[model samples]
Target chain A: MTTNFSRFEGTEDYIVSEDLRNSVNVAVALSKPLLLKGEPGTGKTLLAQSIAKALGLQLIIWNIKSTTKAQDGLYVYDTVQRLYDTQFGNKDVSDIKQYIKLGKLGEAFTSEQQVVLLIDEIDKADLEFPNDLLWELDVMNFHIPETSETITAKNRPIVIITSNAEKELPDPFLRRCIFHYISFPEADMMEQIIKVHYPDLENTLLNEALKAFYWIRSQHNLHKKPSTSELLDWVQALSAGGISPDHIYQELPFLGTLLKKNQDFDTILRRVHNRGTGENQQTGTRIFRNW
Target chain B: MFINFFYLLKREGVPVSITEWMTLMEALSKGMAASSLTSFYYLARAILVKSETNFDKYDLAFSKYFQGIETPAQISDQVLNWLENSLPPLDMNIDLEERLKYQLENLDLNELKKTFEERLKEQKAEHHGGSKWVGTGGTSPFGHSGYHPGGIRVGGASLRRSAVKVAGERKYYEFRGDETLGVRQFEVALRKLRQFTTRLEGPKDLLDLDTTISETCNNAGKLKLVWTRPSKNSVKVILLMDSGGSMGPYYRLCNQLFTAVNKTTQFKSMEIYYFHNCVYDQLYLTPTCRQSESIKTEEFLRTHNSDHKLIFVGDATMAPSELTEVNGIIDWGMTNDEPGLTWLERLAHHFPHNVWLNPVAETYWESSSSYTIQLIKKVFPMFELTVDGLEQAVKKLKVRQ
Candidate 1:
C-alpha cells in the first residue's frame, strides 16, 4: 500500500498507511488528551511530536518518571522554597505572593494557540497519574489552591500520551482517548528511515546493516528490541565506522547500538555464528516494512 | 555531551536553573551517558526546557547573553567530564534481614518459630488462650479491620482483600487480569476490524460497503471521522482453553487472543471450557471453572449452529487416546492416551470450524510428545498462538469461507 507520510517532515521519507496516517492525524486533531500504548521505542512520543509539527503547533512534552505525580506533572509549587522566602528571602509573606510556576502540563494549558502536549512513557509513572488527570483533562483546566485561581487551556492542545505497556493502566483512563499500538516498522520503511537520516551511505552497506538489524530482532528473545530510531542510530554508527554487514557477524558490539538486553546480545552473538537456524534462510537480502 | 550541554547553556546566557542542572545530574547518575548524544539532547531538553516556547527563549537568550562562551558542539565533552566529576554519589545499599528469615525459606525449626513469634509480638497479635472458648469472649488483639474486606487501590484498580494478613505477607501478587498476551495482541489486530464491520451492501468486498465519508472544506484542520458500522458475526461457538500447568507461562497470550476474538468475532454466544493435563471433552471457565457435559460430546457438537467455529485455544500437548477415539469422544476408560495423544486429534476432527492456536513457538511443534498434536496439526495448522497467529487464523477462515 502507498502512503502520504511525506506530509510529515524532518525524517527519512517513507510510505505510511492511510489508516495509520489517519490514526496519527486523528491523534493530532484530538490533541485533546489521547493515550497511546505500544512496544518500547516504537516511536510513540516521536509520533506525538510529529503530529504537533505537522499541525504547525508548539509541542510540549513531559517524559514521565517512575516517581512522577499528578501535581508534579503540572507546575510544581515550590511550597518549601516559598515558605523559606516568606521566612527568609527578604520578602515578607504579603510581598511574597504565591505564584504557580508553570510545569510541562501547566505550560501546555497556558499556551496562546493550539499545541501538542506529549506525555512520553506514561507507563513509567504511577497508573493513578493518568486517572488523576481524567477530570483536569476532560475539563482542560486546573486550580491553584495557593492563589485560588483556576488555570485552563487557551486552545485545547491535542494531547498524545504514550505508554510502553509495562503495566496495565485503568480502563477509564484509556477510554478517554483513541488508542493505537504500533508494531516494529516494516523493513522498507525502516530502510527509508535510514536513507533519510544518512544520505551519503551506500545502498549495499545500508542493506547489510539492515539485514543485521532484522536478523538480530528475529533471532533474539530479548526484553528490549531495537526501535526505528535505534535502527537509524545503528545505520549511522555502522556508516561512520565503515562497518560492513559482511563484517557485522564478526562485530557483535555494533549490534549493541540496536539492542539493549544481554540475552538479546547473546542471541545476536549466536546468530552471527549461525546457531539456531530457521528454514526461511537469512535472505541476506529481504525487503518488507511498508505502511 | 548532553551532560555538558547545560554548561554550554549557562555560558550562553540561558539561565538553566540549578534544578534543571540537577535533573541532568540525576539522569547522568542513573547511567544516561554522554556518549549517547542523540537521546542526550532530548533528555536535557526535557529536563531544562519542556516546551517549544522555552526552546526559542533559551536559544535567543544564549546568543546575546553568553556574549562569547564557545560553541556547544565543540566543548560538550569537556563540560560533560566536569559535570560527571561533580554531582552527588548515589548510595545503593541492600538489607533483607526480614526476607532472609521467613518460613518460606527452608530455615531450621527454631529459627522459623522464633521469627514467627517475633513477627506476632511486633504486630501485638496474640491468640486468646491458644484457641477461643465458646462462652468466654477471648478478644482478638489484632481486631476488627484484619479480616474485613478493606478495598486497597492497586494500579488504579481497587481490589477488596482480607485485612488479617501480615504487612509483609500482604505483598504485591502478580495482578494477572483476564488480559493475556494473545488477547492484547488480538485487540490491536482487530482494531482493523472496523474495516470489516460495514454491511455487505452488494457483491463487492469490505471497502465498497462503507462509501459514506464526509470531507469538509476549509483551512481549519484535516477532517477526521470514525467508522460507523459494528462488525459482529452471530455464530455460536465452543472453545476449550488448555489450562495445562506447563502452558501457564503462555496463558496470558492464550487469553488475549480469545479476548480479541470475543470482541471482533460475531459469534452468537461464546461458551468456553478449561481442561488441564488432559481434555475429557469437559471444559471449565475458572480455576474453579469446570463443566462436565451431561449431554454426550457428540450430541453437543451436532446441536446448534453446525456451522459453529470450533475454536480450541490450547497448546495441543496432551496424550493421544482421548483423540484417536474412533468409537467415541474419549477413551478415558483405557489408560488416558497410552498409545499416543489420539484424544487431541479427535478434538480437531470434531470441530470443522476448529482452529488450534498454540502460544508455543511454531518451531517447537516438532518436539511435542503426543502424536495427537502432530496429527491434529494436519487438520488445524499448529500456529504460534500470538497476535500475528490469530490474524493469520482469521485470514485462513476468511479464505475457507
Candidate 2:
C-alpha cells in the first residue's frame, strides 16, 4: 500500500521546498512515519497539517503531555468507572465496548479512510512512550485483551511525529520512521513564509525587519534565537503598529515578540544600547554590532 | 553485498538492528532508493541512523565501507581555489622542522598567537604540498589538507589533530550526552532518587481499579474508587553547573542532564546556577547575568536548606591553586581570602547529600596532575557525566544516614 503523493503546489499555503517535499513523498510512499525535528516555532507541528491537507487525509492529532503513556494512545480502559457503576449506579454493564475508548492512534487505525496520525511533541512524553508504539506502528494492528479482539488499520495511516529534541527518542523507535530536519528558513524562504501570513506589508518594511531579525539571530551570546513563527508574529505586530523602516530603532520596545527569554531580551537590548552609545569596549563586539 | 556495510556500521557504534537492516534491503529491492548512491545513502541513513549524534559516525563508516565515499568536506570554494593555485618558488631548504616541533609543543597560548600573526604576514602565496606555506599537504604550520605537527588550520579539513587555533567561523553545537541512551533510560535511572510519598488525590492521577473493585464487592456494591498521584520527587536539588571557558566542551552533556531533570516534576524544587572555572564568592542565575546580579555563595547556601542535594557539573580540569590558594581564580580579578576548597567543603557540609559530575572520563582524572580534581574527589563522591554514571550518582545521593 503506497500513497501516490506529490509536492504541495503554491495554490495551497503549504509552500515547501523540493527537498522537504521529496522527503514527505518518500515517507508517504514507504508507509513509514515522518519524524520532524527542528528548533521551536520552526513549524515542525504545522508541517503535519500541511501534509494532511495536501494529501486529502483526515488528521487525528495526539498532543502529548509529560504524563502521556503509550497505552493512552492505543486504548484506555475505564475499569474504575465500570466498577463504580457496577457497584453503586444501576447502569448497563452488558457491553465492555462502552468502557473501552479508542485513543487517537486507535481511532486512526480503526478508521476505514486513510488518516494522518500526528503524534506531536513525542519528546514531551516519558522516554518509554515512543517504544510502546513500535509494534503497533510497524505492524499496523493492536490487540485489546478485554474485548478479545484485534483492531487493525483498513488503510494504513500516514503517521507524522514532531520532536523538539528535548529528550532523545529511543533508537529502536527512531529507526521505524523517516527523519527530516527542518532548518530555519533562509532569506528567500523566510520572505515567502512571511508573505503567506502578512500579504500587504510593504517591501521596504519587510526587508528592514528581516535585516534586523537576521542581525539579532546572529548574536552568538543569545539564549534562544527567534524562529520563523516569531518572525511572522513580529512582522504582523509591526504592520499593525504602523512601524516604518527608518523608525525601526524606535520600535525596540516591540522586540519582546522576537526574543522570548528575558535574558535574551536584556542581553540584546544592553548590547544595542551600549553600541549606540559607543560604550562597547571590545573590538570584536564592535565588529559584530556593525555586521 | 551490503551486509558487510551493516557490519561496518555496527562496528562504528551505529546500533543498526536486524529489522532496520531488512528494511534497508527492502527499500533497495523496491527501487525506492536504488536510483543512485546518494539516494541509497539517504535511505539507509534515514532507516538505520536513528539519532543526530550518530550521523557523523555513519558518514565515517559509510566512507570506510564504500572506499572513496566523501561526505562533502565543509571547505569553501574560495579556499579550494586558493589551495589549488601554485605558489611562486621560495626557499626550498629550511631545516626548522625540529625547532618548529619543539616550539609547537612547548610554546604557551600567548606565544602561539604571536607566532600565528607573524606566519600569516610572512606567508604570501598559496603553496600546495610544501614545507612552509599555509596550504594543503606537506609540513606547513598553517593551512588545510596537509601534515604538520602543530599548525593553525586556515580553512581546510583537519589532518592531524594538532591545530592550536582554527582561523574561521565554525558553527558550534552543544554536545548531546544522552544521544546513545535508550528511551526511558534517564527516567528509570532517576527512579532511585524518588524519596517522596503521596496521598490519594483522585481518579485523574492513576485509577486503582483492582483495589476499587475489590473494596466495592466487599462493601455490597458500594463504589469506592482508589486514586493516587505519585508524590512529586520532593527532594530539593540545587544544581551548581560550571559554564564558559573549559566548560564549553561539556556544555551539551550538562545541558542534557539539566533539561532531563528540569522536565521531571519529581523534585519538590530545583534551582540552577552557573559559575565559571571555580565557584568563587558568587554564582550567576543565568549565563548572561553580570557579576553584580550574582547571588553570594554564602547567602545561597544559607537560603537552601541543609537537605538540598548539590550536584556540581564541571570538567574539574583547572589549576591547582584555584582550589587551594586565595585569589587563585584565573578568569576574574578578585581578592578572595578563602580558597575554593573552603567554599566546596562548606557547601558539602551544608548539603550532606552532594555529588560532583565530571564530564571528563575517570581515567583522565586518575592520570591528571591537577590537585583540584583530587580535592574534589576527597570532598564529594565524583561520577562521570555518562548515563550510567548519573544513575550511580543518583543512587549514592539516595543513600540515607
Candidate 3:
C-alpha cells in the first residue's frame, strides 16, 4: 500500500484541474479503481489514456455495452469452438486450457508490468454487472472453475472506470472505488484546453469563439449542449474557415459545428437571427447619421 | 475529528458508508491529503462521495464542518429577486386589421418555412420594432414581439435563464435524497423486482455448460455444446395512475414515479393507463382522460394475464359514492355502469399480486373523512408512496399472495 507510485500531473495534451489531479493521484497512490463520472465529452475515457501515457504503461481498454457481462471482462471459455475443432481438426481436443481466452481484465492481471485498465462506459452494462466484478476487483484475482485455475494480478494494474451515469451503480461497488466528477471546464481552463488543441490560433478569434460557445452552452433547453470536444471542433472549423472576429458573433459562421441536434440548431439560429437584426438596425442608423 | 465530518456528510443527506470512510482514512494515512486542507477536501470527497448528485451536499457538509473555508461564492438573494421581478416591457402597438391581412396572405406552411430560413440568413443584428428582420416587436414572419400574421417567435423572456446562479446557490435541493423521492431512488427501489427466470423452451442464446458437460460425457467423450436462452427478468408491470382533479397536488411525485418506472429496464413489459379520481369502465391512454382515447376495463383485464404485477398510483381520496355507487365517476361526460369498487375488486381478483400506492400520508388515512380510501384498501394492499413504503411494496409484489 505504501509503494512509491508516479503521481499523475496530467499529460501535456490534457488539461486537468487541481482537484481532479489530486483525486487521480490519491486513487493511484492507494491502488484503488478510480471511478470518473462526467458529461459525455468531458474526457472521462481520455483521462485513462492520459494516465497511461504519463506513466509509460500499457493501456487495456474494456468498452462495455448493454449486453456486456462482468464475466466477459475476465475469461471466456470457447466451448463451441473446442467442440467444432474436435470433429474438424487433428488438434488436442482434451486440453480445455487451449479454449480459454483471456479477456481485458484477465490480460491486465497477467501483464508483466502494471498497466492502465480502463473500463469505459461501465453504466452501459446490466445493473448487476458492477456488483459481479466487486470480488474480482477487491481481491485483484478471479477463479476459473472450468480450468481449475485462479488468475491473480501480477502487479495490481491501475484501474480507471468511466461512467456516463446512465444507471445508478450499486453502492457496494461504489464503496470500493475512488470517485471523481469531471465538471465542464470553466472559461480559463477551457481556454487552456483550446490552446493545447490550437497553439498558433489568433487571440481575437479564440476569444470570440469562447464567448459564443459559452453563450450557446448557457441556453438550458438544448438537447445536447456543446461540451469541450465540440468547442475544440468548432474552433478548428473557425480557424480553418479563416473567419474574422467581428463576423464570428454577427453571423456565427459555423453554427452547425457547435449545435448538433436539429431543435438546438433551430433554437440558436432563431436567437442569433433576432440578435443580428438588432445589431443591423443600430449600424444602419449610425451610417445614415454619418452620411 | 475528521470522523465528525463523516457524520456531518450523513446528516447533510450524503449516504457516506463506513467502508468509504475507512478508505478515506487509509488514504489519509498514506499522506494522500498532502497536509493541505484543500487537498484533503478533494481527497475526502473522492473517497466518501460516489455520485456527483451528492457532491453539493458534501460541499455543504464540508463547509459546515470546516467553517470559514472558502466555499464557492454565492450570488446574493437580492440579485436573484431583481432578475425574477424585472420583466421585459411589453409592446403595446397592435394593428389587428393589418396583422390579419398579412396572416391571411402568408397562410401557406411551405412559404412560411422557406421565408423563416431565408430571413435568418439575411438578418445581421437584433432589430427591435422592425417589420422585416427577425427581431423583437417586428411584423416580419420571424421575431418575438409585434406579432405578424404567421411569425415564428425567436426567443422569450425565459432566454435570460442562467445556470451560473443555480451553481452559485449550490443547494441542489432536488438531488438531495433525504428531501424527497427522486426518480433515481424510485428506479433503485423498483430494480428489486428484477428476478430473472430462464425459460427452458426459448431461443438458445447462452451457453449451458452443465448440460453440455453431462451430455458430452453421456456421448462417450464426444464434445456436445448446448445453448439455452439467457435468464431474463420476466416481471411485467401494469401501472394504473389516477390523474387530474384531486391528484393534481401529487402530479410531480406521480410523474417522477412514472418516469422512474419508464426508465427502469428490468421489466419485460409495461402498460400505463390514466384515470380520474377512481377507476370506472374505461381508462384513458393520456392523462387528460378524454372519451375518445379510452379502452374498456373488461377488455384490458381479458388481454393482460394475472402474471403482470398491478400497481395503482393515486391519492385514493374521493366521494364515497364515487367508489360504491353506480354512475358516480367524477367525469361529467361519461357514466359508469358498475361502481369503482367493483372494478377495483375485479382488478385485484384478476391480478393476485397487486399493490396500491397512496400519495396521502398513512396517518391521514385513518382520520380521513373520505370513505373511498378505506373501501379501496379492502380490495388491494395499500402503501404510502414514500421510499420505505415503496421498498416494502416491491417486496410484497415479489411474494405470491
Interface RMSD of each: 24.3, 7.0, 12.1
The worst-scoring run of ten residues by lDDT in candidate 1 chain B lies at B131-140
N/CA/C clash count, model 2: 3
Docking class of 3: acceptable
The native-contact fraction of candidate 1 is 0.00
| Model 2 lDDT per residue over B309-341, tens place | 888888887888888899887655566788888
Q: What are the clash counts of all predictions, listed in order? A: 31, 3, 14
Can you write out model 3's per-residue Cα lDDT over A1-291, one digit (the tens) per residue?
245633788989998877788888888888899999989999999899999999999999999999899999999999778778987778898889999999999999999999999999998887789999999999999999998999999999999999997777877899999999888888878999989988999999999999998888886568999988888888999999888888887778788888788988887777787676664312221111100
Rank the models by TM-score, top first.
3, 2, 1
Ranking by lDDT: 3, 2, 1
List per-candidate RMSD values in Å.
30.0, 12.1, 16.5
lDDT of 3 by residue, B1-401 (tens): 48888788888789889888888888878777767666777788889888777878887887667642223322234323322432343344456556557666758755665666566555554566556765554355454435555444444331222111222235434455544567768887898887788963568878898998899899888878788898888999999998757787787888878878987877889999998888888888987677889999889998999999999999988889888898887766578888889989989999989999999989888875957788888888999998888999999998766
**TM-scores of all models?**
0.41, 0.73, 0.74
Candidate 2 residue pairs in backbone clash: B137-B145, B137-B146, B233-B266
Per-residue lDDT tens digits of candidate 1, residues A1-291?
A: 113212444322443433345445433333335556556766676776667666577888888988788887677665445545544547655532354577788888888887778888886775457788788777888988777778898888777778776545665565455455454676777776666667788988877777767766775356677777787777778778877557754564476688777876765665566643543334443333111
- What residue runs in model 3 are displaced by over 4 Å at the alpha carbon? A1-6, A84-89, A200-209, A220-222, A235-291, B68-202, B207-226, B231-233, B245-256, B280-282, B286-307, B319-353, B386-388, B391-401
What is the TM-score (0 to 1) of candidate 2? Answer: 0.73
Model 3 lDDT, residue B154, Cα = 46
All candidates: DockQ? 0.01, 0.23, 0.24
| lDDT for each residue of candidate 2 in A205-244, tens digit (9 for 90 to 100) | 8988988888788877778999988888888888888887
Q: After superposition, how far is residue A135 of candidate 1 from its true place, in Å?
A: 1.5
